[model samples]
Target: MTVTATKFTPEVMLSAPRRSPGVPNPSGKLVLYTIRVLDIESGNSELLTEDPEAGCPVWVGEEKVLYLKTDSRGNTTFIVRSVKSPEPESYDIGKINAPLSDLKVKKLPSGNIALACSALVNPDGELVNPETDKKPLSSAKVYTSLFVRHWDTWNSDRKRSIFYGALGEEDGKLVLLGNTLTNALGGTNLSSPVPPFGDSADFDIGPSGLVFVAKDPELDPATYTKTDLYFIPLKTFTEPQAPAPRIIKTPGLEGYSQTPVFSHCGTKVAFTRMHSRQYESDKTRLILVPDINNPDVTEEFYATEDGAGGWDSRPEAIAWGLDDSHLYVSAEFHGRRMLFQLPSTPSKATQFPKLIETPKGSVVGFSVLHRPGSETTVTTADILFVSSTSLIDNSCYSIAHPGTLECRLISSTSKEGKSFGLSRSQVDSIWFSGAGDYDVHAWVVRPSTFSKDSKKKYPLAMLIHGGPQGAWNDSWSTRWNPAVFAEQGYVVVCPNPTGSTGYGQDFEDAITGNWGGRPYQDLVRCFEWIEQNMPEVDTDRAVALGASYGGFMINWIQGQPLGRKFKALVCHDGVFSTLNQWATEELFFPIHDFEGTLYENRAAYEKWDPARFANEWATPELIIHSELDYRLPVTEGLAAFNVLQAKKVPSKLLVFPDENHWVLKPENSLVWHREVLGWINKYSGVEEEQKSN
Candidate 1:
């Protein structure tokens, strides 16, 4: 078998089948999606019964999709869509966030009923857009997972008013503490009480009590950085007792680490190190340490991947099957991602994956949506993924390994013939060098309809990605507006330049202070490659558009000599200057520095400032960002806009109060897409340019 490296093209990746846990189901079968399922596998899927705005669907029995349906009037309601029955009935979970977290309606071994739930809360009355320099209010649409005591949800805080800058549930007694940002639990409910860290955390229940780790570093509620493990007793606090916290590790690892997992037997623990602190170039190391601190033989190796090859730390979503050998773990190795089940005991030199299931989108945290039965074997077991993407609805899939490729959406639907109507345009992976050995990864989505016989060329559009440490992957995007452009008459290019994650830590680290250096070269090289290889694309008519870190790229590009290569430039919530960004209070985490503060990196930051290049930016630009974009605040875009206006560069700005860093509403999303596409058409009307060429 030939293993081909991914082509840095966007066609296949953008349209690739993806699995996300947005459209949830009772079991991981019926998936509720916003778009109709297209080009799906034969007889494996059932088209959902409701509108595309519906979310979180579950199979009530075998024929129904349990989910929330949103109407055009901006009202969301819970309902059950049936496959065999062909009738849909409203099953209001009532004001609760649809697709309940760890949503389960199962009978216990002892036969008692259990129901759990969660949602984002904003008791602070915060109604401001997130400042790019400060920790944007955690209040903006963040979720907090919960476990409801009973079914009645009439008086819940989330139900009061689902209005603008709305507040989520603040009245429920959420049981599980699974990961950062929210409280999540696994297995049976814990007898131990929850901890108060101001931020979210996960837990493990043992014979002694409940054990969990607070990934935050500082004791200060605002600037927490260090992560530590602590044990909470079953007893509740009557008197004001200062809780005792025990440090699990002396150094406490580094960078951003969380999700301390307990071994199957409950005597040990496993967690991904993510990255090694700040600026440290190493892959996220997975280590297994024993529950007891024994002088001799306390810890042993379970399994681990080498190097900072862009692994997502805090992989708490791991599942260990009944038989120890059949261990399931999620990893982002081999450039793409797949679930690997390695044998517990190694007989041969290579203890390769025992049972494997690779999901379409990059698989993050995962768990057995349904564990194997008492008599189930390694070959005969059920595994569910929490992610699926065909561009519209993010849903889950039930992958029955060892059988026919049976991918059933927990909320999404699979039509009778083709699985889902959703089929991504073909994406091919390719790499190009920016400077020296430093290469960049990219995806190119070609125009839906193209002319091969005629020399007529199509317009090229550059789509930028955020997460200076995050990489743009082969996942279908509900908001990835570039696809619409491709469907029209435009060719789109997205590059995982130097600063992007997934390639390796150094690849990401290289961009820390050199954001405009190697990273910029990579984008330039991508443009040049498209010009040379994709002659069907018009070079001068090409435009650049991105948000956050990607938005920063556009700013830097406008300033560079390569700025002459692009015609129209669009900035979406991009960072304008490094100094202003650094000086502002970013969230509580002290990430601006690992060993020291930004005071230490003053010189490095100055060199990386994007504002310095504003004088050279002559490209006709469009600035579309929100007033409340905290990730890359409106100020950054404003700074660029100020420059463009002052220098008399053709520029415009589109600001929306309803949107934050990301625009989520359907109407808003459509508007955003239409605006971007319109800009491309308005400025880069390429028929004239191509004819001249």
Candidate 2:
């Protein structure tokens, strides 16, 4: 069969069907994932449902599946469909008081299926329905707390919490028990599933109880990342009074607690915990509670002989082996998100995790597939179904054998890269000596039409990643995609410098209070390496782009000697001044990164302040910020643009009123790409070719 390759444009990337993590059925014969079902053995896939508003598909039992479908009017319906039946059974849950999402279900011991979903509720634990509930005549919001506003929105009297009810059958019709849903966190004045990015992963439901993570209400949310794990015992779906949730304390581990997974038997729980309260980028240690009934007895599985000498990579997501003897974890390694396996039980001797060899690209998520009757055994039949993506592929699923440590491709979004004119060969990397004489890794993505034998050279696009602690992983991304830039006739180079994760803790810690020091020098060396080594890259016609901390670097670069190297620059939601960063929502981020509060450590902030060196800013730049970006705030972008305009430097400012830290909406994303690419291309001379075409 002959297939035609197409240019991977912004529209193509945006219009592509998004693939979500899938859940496997109890039998493991079929996978209920990505709005489709795949027969594992036959390798045949069929759409299970279709709708832009449909999501959160979960398996109810071996033969049944449940999901939620919301209409344009904001009304949600609970859908239950049998694998054998042609039609699905749906019950109108009616219009929730707030936005309802993150559906989870667990079959109770009494044969009743308990359903839990998250939504906003008032301080009194009553559902907060902006559409149907009464509101004061004034639109003004008064807040006396630290978090008057969060990531993108202003704080209200309502908080995001979990609501629970039983899915039952009455008179041959599926219905919600008690004809109403009760807030699982009712009367607690606590919000489960933390804000902004938290989802179903923040809480898990088991036969015995529900486990969730919530920030300590007494602490200021803006300053502390301390969230405790809480367990709520469940007996009846409809209880007269919801039992007060008990905090599962992990002594000496007070940072962010996340991803609580219940053992298959519901007797134990496994989660990840960080040690520091202020640093959000601390190493996540795998934590295990052998007995849920005795929550105080917690064990740290991957601890070092001393306190800080052992494994350094932060575990992102974790899953347990079917037998619960082994735990599977995914963490950033070098530049890839690698999967590792470790014994679930604590060891007397120093122990390290074993690496599981998987396909190229990072493992986004995975599900343990246990064959029928093999749930209690560590057999070869048990497969870890992993979902991953790379710079070339949007989605790919592979079946990994735990025993052999071998991975085989099962299916992908498309047959091959030919479908989108992308190839794995075009994705390459290099290691160079950077600041501090340490080896720094950088990914180099060449255009699909790139050829070393050809006389043509491609313009250089230097892409910087955010997190400052985040690395440019070998993973797919819709926003700030290197492929998008490479396809535009630019050789995209993304450097994982100091402060980047996947390296060691000391490397990541080097960025603390040295935001513009080592990392900036690393980028300078990376640019020089490409210039001196790659004859196919036109470094003279180069452009640099970044967002968040990366954006901060662009602003920082505009004042350094490196500013003269870039032909053009793009800063998305970057910091304008280190001292003014106190206006950000998450104070802990700047506090920890800068080493202390602004008042307590004014010199640290002043040392790295980009505004201090604004006199050297002469680069033609494009500044992008969103009105809702509480993390960096719109003022940061405006402040940078103001300085540029005052100096009469060629510059443009683009602001999205509706977006937060990212341009998420499809239409908005298209505009973002067009403006950013057009600006950079014009300065890099690629615009002339585009105009002629």
Candidate 3:
């Protein structure tokens, strides 16, 4: 009998990575997140919190834990109590009426406490009344953002939704960052907005107020994206007085404003931006702003760099050693994601990022990785990352030792484990011929157990990625379903053709207006490669699969001269007409907008639309889409399906009721996999002996 690992199991019981380890209290012992109390330990850990469902936790003292609890009022009431000293007694000291993100707690050098939280929807950062259901108090109305999930992965300790951003300039002459946020009033008291680059999520400050800032990204109208840095001045804000911040500005920053960050020594600041292809990153530049808080005199914009730039290299994670000798920043260059080491001295070129981890095994290289530096250096670490492996689904690592940057497995929803699994892939790379003599690249995986002695050529499947610029990266794809197929005796291949990124910017640009031509050749070439190189792959029985842009490609391929090569095609939420796509509510990705707009690029749109070529289609196809998909809305799939059905082609359309661009939730994902499998089996003939074996 075919054996699937009994069933799926999650790996850890801890909270999500987006939620951070609670900041340690002054004595350096206690840490709390949610309802539970946490204690620092030296080795591998076990959950220590006593209360269940206690979401946000923080360390208050060596013997105490402070956590946020929603008292029917909807306000997150902060409670501090002794976890070690006996009776489990705790006191409710205060609460923030405003919704918050990246809540932080730290013991001050003076033995007092520093609490920092950001408010997004309401500027006044008013706390929510869970009991009364009152809205946040703010003059500026918050945008009912539909793109919230895309921009943030933060969870709130209270009713207000939370978002994370990096730090920016202006602190008490010292540098520091801890999850920075848009205060309820959308105003940061002292620091500027996060710069344009770097990624931020649920965050917490360092122990005893030593940690100070969080690096976030914001746009610079002049330069595009600049990393804006921010921090809470715990030492100064410890008084009864609320924080009073001085507004600071840099050279060329007269007009544009966005994400920002600060350097370790408090001497420099960095920023990032998402620029149209027109503005490529040059180098990391440092602009000096007057230290108005300092008695030192005159200062105008003196643009200078220690030569080690903070440019193109968008700063994601900023790690400052206890002594401030080593600095770490995460950056993506070429096809590999890496970490760069910035020396305490300005003269040295920022050292290239040392690779900590990749999809699986030894990451031959990386496309993106984020590591947060700390006084703990190689030992203590917190990292949030997106890998070709993780695909845009961000993953995290807590207590990431520089020794092993891999994060700890923790899911906020459950205390259960086994959420992630490591699977083995056999093909390093597969090559195949296209329309002409051109070639395509693909990676193939066989079922967990296979034998050359067996005569059965397995049923085959292909996975197509969206971005005409997006290429298939080697990573764990919860949706890719290759492993699940392999578990069911099907061989899987994912191809990266001419239009994909990671290969190079030029390769990506090549398909800008030529989507229907050369890129199509690459897809065909990949299939041929599978037929020729993968002897175990049944050439006659295969399926064409893709989503989003890939979905568009699949429909376009059906009308190609060699369209009948595959008997089955699976199109998942793809675009059928450039005209309809342009008219949709979806906000196009930056590069897509830059190439051309609907009005100006109409000719290219017509040439790229598969709907025009639908008459040439002859193969059977299956369509899957989300009713709420605005990106490559359901209309595209509907149009293609209608034409196919009208033409009398065997075609079917499946719509997910409550999903979007991507399907979420564990149970939904499981069903999705099953649906795709059933589609393949119903259309492509699976050998009976193969299923039994």
Q: How well is each residue in 256-281 modelled by candidate 1, as lDDT tens digits?
A: 33455554454555544443443323
| Full ranking by lDDT | 2, 1, 3
* lDDT (tens digit, per residue) of candidate 3 on 97-190: 5333345554444444545554334335433444565555764434343222221121222323222222222331111233222232124422
The reply for model 3, stretches above 4 Å from the true place, is 1-4, 7-44, 48-53, 56-74, 79-93, 96-99, 105-113, 120-235, 238-271, 277-318, 331-347, 350-427, 431-441, 499-501, 584-594, 687-693
Better of 2 and 3 by TM-score: 2
For model 2, the superposed segments whose C-alpha errors exceed 4 Å read: 1-5, 85-98, 168-175, 348-350, 379-381, 691-693
The numbered model that scores best in TM-score is 2
TM-scores of the models, in the order given: 0.68, 0.96, 0.68
lDDT of 3 at 315: 39
Comparison by lDDT, 1 against 3, better one: 1
- The digit string of per-residue lDDT tens for model 2 on 7-42 reads 988987887666776577888888888667777777
lDDT of 3 at 648: 96
Predicted structure with the largest lDDT when compared to the true one: 2
Q: Which ten residues in a row have the lowest lDDT in candidate 1?
A: 158-167
Error of 3 at 628 (Å): 2.6
